[model samples]
Target: MAQQLDNDLQFEDRFHRKFYYLRLSVTDVCNFKCTYCLPDGYKPTEKKKPSFLTLNEIERVTRAFAECGTSKVRITGGEPSLRRDYTDIIRIVAAQPGITKVATTTNGYRMEKNVKEWREAGLTHINVSVDSLDPKMFYQITGENMFHKVMSGIDAAFDAGFEQVKINTVLLKNQNSQELPKFLAWIKTRPIQLRFIELMQTGEMDLLFQKHHVSGVSIRNHLIANGWLLKINGKNDGPAQVFCHPDYMGEIGLIMPYEKDFCQSCNRLRVSAKGKLHLCLFGDHGVELRDLLSADEQRTELISRIQGGLKEKAVSHFLDAGNTGMTPNLASIGG
Candidate 1:
């Protein structure tokens, strides 16, 4: 335990920002054809199907992260629940020492039937993507005609004993932008947190980004004008700036990547589904970590590599300069 505490204190970067959260992508194959992400649906690699990190590899990486001060791990993917051993994955992550919060971000397609099992597997929290509250707009945005089904899945999550379930809505101009009132009303009587993420420009979506990207700043201004109070983030929290209202049962979180000093308070690191370490979401490239994850005895080397890789992390992503890095789309890295 003392050794773990010592290692925990050593995980900070040059800027003194301590990393306590890990975003671990399990796979890159999504089932949704969201307009912003995969308008043409998921396409397999031309050569062959990509091999994702195995459960053993996932365990090794997660244990190393936990030892290095990561207490919260959010399992993501093109759609993480699509994995046959998804629950087992959750259990494995939860069992790792020092890992206190085991969470996942899913599309909620299987929540109605599998949420209870997931909860039993030790999942501490969940975030479901529901782009729009309106059924028609939801279908149009996600390219799936199952908005109501997803909503039902949220209900199932609550019934399964989750205290709060965050709903992710990518702010798209002229798409679901005008539905804030409807969204606020929907969350007024529920414990749901509505997270509005500004549409980011990836390598493959320049034209679409120019046409539809909406600044989360607009929504932040609206919240301030409407009596919502900004809340300070916890030590191990993610990048969202959360707000709360006295009269509402829910809270609002704004993820404005373009905001000044947005990355200054970054407290998380991301690992790709293929076992590569991404310093930033908009980073130029990833440092391969898979070769160091093949054996249990390789954990010491894995930890050393992770610590060395942190030295190369940039001060900021510099998205304002139009640098989107090698990320062709969000699905490729489980964004």
Candidate 2:
């Protein structure tokens, strides 16, 4: 029952954290310029960076991670669907020897037209980013008025036979935080769990923290105060602290890295669109793997770096501690 690529290698980190989950970003390009992600008046650029990893590099790196005990892999990006051969990449990775589950986090812009293809390609899980239910508010948050279209895509995902769909909502202060209670009631009619994520200390801080960042603690307290009974089920080994209410139709998840740092139980490593292996989200440094991938270096080469970097992986992110160094943008870091 163990996840394995070929029954040869098992990788462990210095912190004794086994890398069973890996999040890989296929591209840094995004269609909508969300205020939290990019600054105002941000121009969309179409030029693809030459250093971005191809489907082949993603396959090789994924194989390496699988060899090291990565069984659950999530494809992430500015928007993973942006890749012309996105489904092809999913098929390639999902078909690997030991990969048990292949998931993706997307903006759901093109999902309606492509969910069936992705499902056929071995995509077993999905997380859609939807901040608000209102079209005007959605556009204000994401800088694009695609709320209806995105909702249609979510509908398509359900119709495509993905048993469990996850909706990721980033609750900003006065912006969409008010949607917390409403969203809880709204998602119950569906077969998906609405996960509220606490804003991480990534990208522009001045624009993100002071105005938007709402603590997960506040949200949970609000839920409890609103006559919601807490019930727990399933595994709590992942990032989100799982919660449920009997009255609600689905479930809820809170990703509070700042309030309750889960770095000690961190089980994943992230691969950026440019093929950099990031040991920690708040870590200032990363291992550049593009050169090694292009060089067709042995798996041992990449494995060696992962093993060495594990020695320096922070026990917890430095966000609250104010010790964080210059961090990469979420798109570049695969957040």
Best by lDDT: 1
Backbone Cα, N, C clashes tallied per candidate? 0, 0
Clashing pairs in 1: none
Cα lDDT of model 1 by residue, 57-136, tens digit: 99999998888888999999889999999999999999998988899999999999999999999999999999998899
How many Å off is the CA of 227 in candidate 1?
1.3
lDDT of 2 at 3: 55
Best by TM-score: 1
RMSD (Cα, Å) for all candidates, in order, is: 1.4, 2.8
lDDT of 2 at 157: 96
In terms of lDDT, the poorest run of 10 residues in model 2 is 229-238
Deviation (Å) of 252 in candidate 2: 0.7
Error of 2 at 182 (Å): 1.7
Per-residue alpha-carbon lDDT of candidate 2 for residues 1-335, written as tens digits (9 for 90 to 100) = 34534433565566676778888988877787777776453333445434578877888888878777778889988788988999999998998777888999998999999999999999999999999987899999899889999999999998999977899998788888888757876777777888899877665665577768888787778767866555543221358766666666677888987765467677888888888888877788888777667544667887777777677777777678764555645766678
Error of 1 at 20 (Å): 0.6
